[model samples]
Target: MATAAIARPQVSDAEWEARQELAACYRVFAMLGWDEMIYNHITVKVPGEDNAFLINPYGLHFSEVCASNLVKIDIDGNKLTDNPYPVNPAGFTQHSVFHRHLPDAHCVMHTHTTAGMAVSALEGGLQPINFYACNFIGQVAYHDFEGVTVRAEEGERLIANLGDKRAMFLRNHGILVMGKTLPQAFLMHWGLQRACEIQMATLSMGQPVHVPEDVVAVHQRDLSKVQIPGGPGKADFDAMVRLVDRIDTSWRN
Candidate 1:
């Protein structure tokens, strides 16, 4: 099916740049196979705007998203842009909670990958059996699955469980990660998804996976030290954007 052309809403330079970065994020997710059709969403706050943000349009695949096509909406789910696609109500319900509560979280990503959902269903979520898993040892939060997150009231509970953590495991549902920038959020989700994958693989071996608590602690500390602004994540995100362009630059449209 042919995707609709964006109406190109009037936005400032900063907001346009944000749209491009967020559109690139959607493409990267699609490239990594993390996108669950058109279900999951990655939302970023519109630069310089308090209550406005950008989100994937409903019914379009992640690969089909572009800077101009992303829908702009307010905290109350009102569309500020003339978009042909509707916003996902559940997505708004979950993301608005974070954007409103966590003032520092500029980028919020949600995914329903196989490994992520698998770990979410496990009684022991995100085991620290591997280096990737260890990075989130003391940084992960958990929210119990409460059916679909379409209710406006559920946002408060979600916020409460998330606290100030950067990553969260949505019990029996999926994963949520937030960051001060798109790069940080993307890297966080990458690490978390990999950790979940490693955990599942280690469990299938049915053998004791041993990583000393001291070692895990060291790794966690190292990871924390690298969480500086415009750090490695920014460079890596730039590289990924180049890679996506090499494959197909249509996502930049």
Candidate 2:
């Protein structure tokens, strides 16, 4: 079936640019196999709008998402635009909590990747076994799964668990990553997924060699200061955007 072309939303230049970057994030999610059909969400705050943000339309695959097709909604899950597609209630409930409580969280992404889910189910969330894992030491939180996230109180619990952290493990479910910018969120997810993948692979063999706690602490501190273009998330995302454009440029619409 041929998909209809997306008409760009009438928004400010900043918002339009945010939509494009978010759309690019979705396309990259598809490219990296981070998308779990239509079950998860990657959302970015709309510039200049308090309690407003952009999220993927409910039925669209990550690959099918485009800037114009993205839906704008308030923290309460009310649609702020005249979009035909419905928003995912679970997505809103989980993401809105961070968007509303954390002033610095401009982007929030949730994923149900295999490795992430496996790690989430483990007794320990993410371990500092490698460089990627080391980056998350003392920086990850855990939330006990309470079925689907659709109730208001769940948001409260989620925020309490997340408290100032950039990443979280939704036990028996998946992972969530947040950032002050879209690029930071994407990079955080990438590093987290890699860490989970490595952890699972090593566990399959036997107990993995753990980096010394002091050395891990040092690595975390040093890594936190390592910023590249676009705030530690730019270089790789730019490369991935070009790659996805080569495959299909419709996401830019």
Candidate 3:
């Protein structure tokens, strides 16, 4: 698929902004070594259209995704724009279901990072032993894996298992996170990933100390609706986007 910049006015400013942010997200994941080749997906619903979303071209690496080349598709995976690139079947199947069912799921991210996969494979799942783990003590949900997630039936189960939770682990597979905003989702995954990495490291050595539930409850209560000191907010996302531009502003295309 060509990465050539899409001509302007073909899309609304809101849609274009969504493209740039989604593209920047891909690059940020690439920089963090969280991408699984060209397999995993980060999807964002187009701001101006209902049930319409954008995904990376199936054959393109995260680094290769640009605002213009990102494929625009509807909830049913039908291409809404003319493009040489195709959308990944698995990505579409899962992402569409989430978008259709959850209003807050404006941005859905699925990844197969080593730590994310490792945590998913573990029977214990993500434990509340690390600072990052505290953000999702009782917040994480789990789903039983049903082969590759290309089938629509599997999507129903995925959403059912997801319930109202923002983060989910596809047991024996990987991590899935949703957010009302990209910053929230990205921060959730970052915290989850760091938790898993720390858990794996500490478990290899011996029994790890767990954070108290009372403390987590308190934090969860206090953390809602307010931007804590180190919390991932819009500011953090803006900083990361700047970093992506420094590396390569092609994402802005």
Candidate 4:
């Protein structure tokens, strides 16, 4: 865990809360092994600001991230706050598109987990092979890999491909999820990761049992019931937040 050497920024209470939540998400991602070295991103729009948002500083491991260390940036990825940490605008170009174009897209996350990349490389692309996968039937969208996503022009095409879906499969790349809040996005990625894991496991054992279309449709119809109780992904994310706190609470600094 990182020490609290970084000074907390002067900001609104809502923004502070956003920063804490975003920082906790980084620790949670690190705890879950969803981190990819110093790469990957989970961005959240700063409350009461149209273009301002929070993201992980470049070159910091997820485990080293904290509320005070998160970099605040604008729609164009320019730093909006004073900080010694470096910001990688090009790295988060893909995330900016979602944050700009999508409604309620307060949080956008991307990951390069092994199972996620495996499923992305598959020709079928996230088939409904299990319950977790079934919940996203006809809801997940795919965008062809257009190299490192540094090009701003690709955003239009990616948005067109994604339509209104919250989950996206970055073909030959990895997985992406967006949400109105961190908890919702966290749960979405958790389900996506589990879906990929189970799908890979089942495929290795030869022909798997097929889930009838009717069952899949029913599952989709009732996915709301399976959501985090009392709020969208609230209980699930809060529980994980608790677990991460137990491991190391330094993320809140």
lDDT top scorer: 2
What lDDT does each candidate get? 0.89, 0.90, 0.87, 0.89
Residue 43 lDDT (model 4): 93
Model 1 bad stretches (over 4 Å): 224-229
Error in Å for residue 151 of model 2: 0.7
Q: Clashes in each model (backbone N, CA, C under 3 Å)? A: 0, 0, 0, 0
Tell me the tens digit of each residue's lDDT in model 1 across 1-253. Answer: 4688876678898998898899998999998999998899999999888898999999999999999999999989999988888999999999988888788889999999999999999988878788898888879999999998899999888888888788999999999999988998888999899999988889999864767889998887777575656664797788889999998887666
lDDT of 4 by residue, 74-188 (tens): 9888888887777665556888888888868999999999999999999989888898999887889999998888889999998999888989999999999999889989989
Q: For residues 173-248, could you state the per-residue lDDT of candidate 3 as single tens digits? A: 9999999888878888888888889988989999989889999888788776667555455777778888888989
**Candidates ranked, most accurate by TM-score first:** 2, 4, 1, 3
Instruction: Tally clashes: model 2.
Output: 0
Task: Give model 2 RMSD, 1 decimal.
Answer: 1.4
Which segments of model 2 are wrong by more than 4 Å?
Answer: 1-5, 224-226
Pairs with backbone N, CA or C atoms under 3 Å apart (clashes), candidate 2: none
What is the alpha-carbon lDDT for the whole of candidate 1?
A: 0.89
Off by over 4 Å in 4: 1-4, 227-229
